[model samples]
Target: MTSVPMIDEILAEFLQSGLGIHVGTRNEQLLPAGCRATAIKVEDDGRHVVVFVPKSAAPAVFENLRTNGRIAVSMARPADDRAAQVKGLMMFSWDANPDEEALARAQWAGFLAQLDGIGLPGIATSSWRVFPCRAVRVKVTAVFNQTPGPDAGAALP
Candidate 1:
């Protein structure tokens, strides 16, 4: 099979920079669920993107994915107000492996640092429950530049 990147290098770099990540889903009844993302990875193939959030933190998201499969993830660097969004169908949702957990920890730390750099400090995360995570994998159907600008909402190539 031929392989193509779901996200190019620039977008990938931006996503890896400890931005604020949020994931979205809807149940069969069209009820929306959202939760902070704990970690993210774009596979080497570049077509599969995996996002992590603790199961305890987002049971509704997982349940929604299982039944509805539609998924959308938004990422942003709030200090600069740059943002992007990806929408796709859920490929799978699973318990995070050991390596995935480590990735989550690293990204969460980076996010904390970013918050501090923006002069916001001591943000409480205890309620986030970002551990013993669940990973949701999505096959990218579309990506958009969500940053506010003249070209905001443009579809990324």
Candidate 2:
């Protein structure tokens, strides 16, 4: 695996804010599955990220990652629509720890608050608690800017 540089403070802040987190994976048959991540944890070094997914709501996505490692994750800031997309190989996927679960719940709450602040109809907080969740670690291979404008879709340096 290629060693990518640790994410900078700007991107780290964007991710830690829990604005938007979506994860996608594909099955052996090439069928795609995606689910919103309830929580995102960027390791201090920024070389890795773990996304928590509710087992009940994203069984297919979990299964896909378990069966096939290819994965893509996208995140966007609700305040300004600045966004990024990452494609990577799954490094690990397992039941989330208690701390991870708690963090995810808290982050989900923050995400909802951001939505509400923006005058958007927020999803019920209860919706995030399907329980028996899994946390998947991704080793990023490529990243692209997904924000609108000329720089959109360009590969990140």
Candidate 3:
């Protein structure tokens, strides 16, 4: 018999539950530019690659990503089942173009508004942009349990 690593196990659970949050941060400042997104998909080859849609929330979500160079994310699992835990990781921006993608999604207006609160300072407030999601390799840093109880037992695969 063989055993699958916890990362592999968690990824399986993530696929079952198609919802998660994609977080991005600044490289220099290291300040968290809060951004929420839906787990669109995940690809695991050598490393895990998680794709998300930041549906018209904040432009900084994408801008900060450009300046910062990387991002992180957390995804929730089933409510009752406690077999798995929330997955978190710092994702590197391999290739991304906000302007091009934003045009496609048509959520440019909404994303710009969200960035206003962030106060990019020197950065100018631009129209909504769609980040068509150029995939990146995500190194799974940690996986921790949300609740600890008798229910914290193995779940069905």
Candidates in order: C-alpha RMSD to true structure? 1.6, 2.5, 10.0
Superior by lDDT: candidate 1 or candidate 2: 1
For candidate 3, report its TM-score: 0.47
Report the Cα lDDT for candidate 3.
0.45
Write down the TM-score of every candidate.
0.91, 0.87, 0.47
Residue 131 alpha-carbon offset, candidate 2, angstroms = 4.3
Sort by TM-score, best first.
Answer: 1, 2, 3
Worst 10 residues of 3 by lDDT: 121-130
Error of 3 at 72 (Å): 2.2
Q: Clashing pairs in model 3?
A: 27-68, 101-130, 102-129, 102-130, 108-128, 108-129, 109-128
Give each model's whole-structure lDDT: 0.84, 0.79, 0.45
lDDT of 2 by residue, 17-77 (tens): 8768788888988889998777778777567788787777667887788787888889888
lDDT per residue for candidate 3 within 64-119, as digits (tens), equals 66564465554443333233333334455433455535432333333333344355
Better of 1 and 3 by TM-score: 1
Ranking by lDDT: 1, 2, 3
Residue 100 error for model 1, in Å? Answer: 1.2
Model 1 Cα lDDT, one tens digit per residue, 1-157: 7777879887888887777899998998898999888878887776778988777765788888888789999998857879999899888878999988988888888888888888878784555577888888899889999998899889986
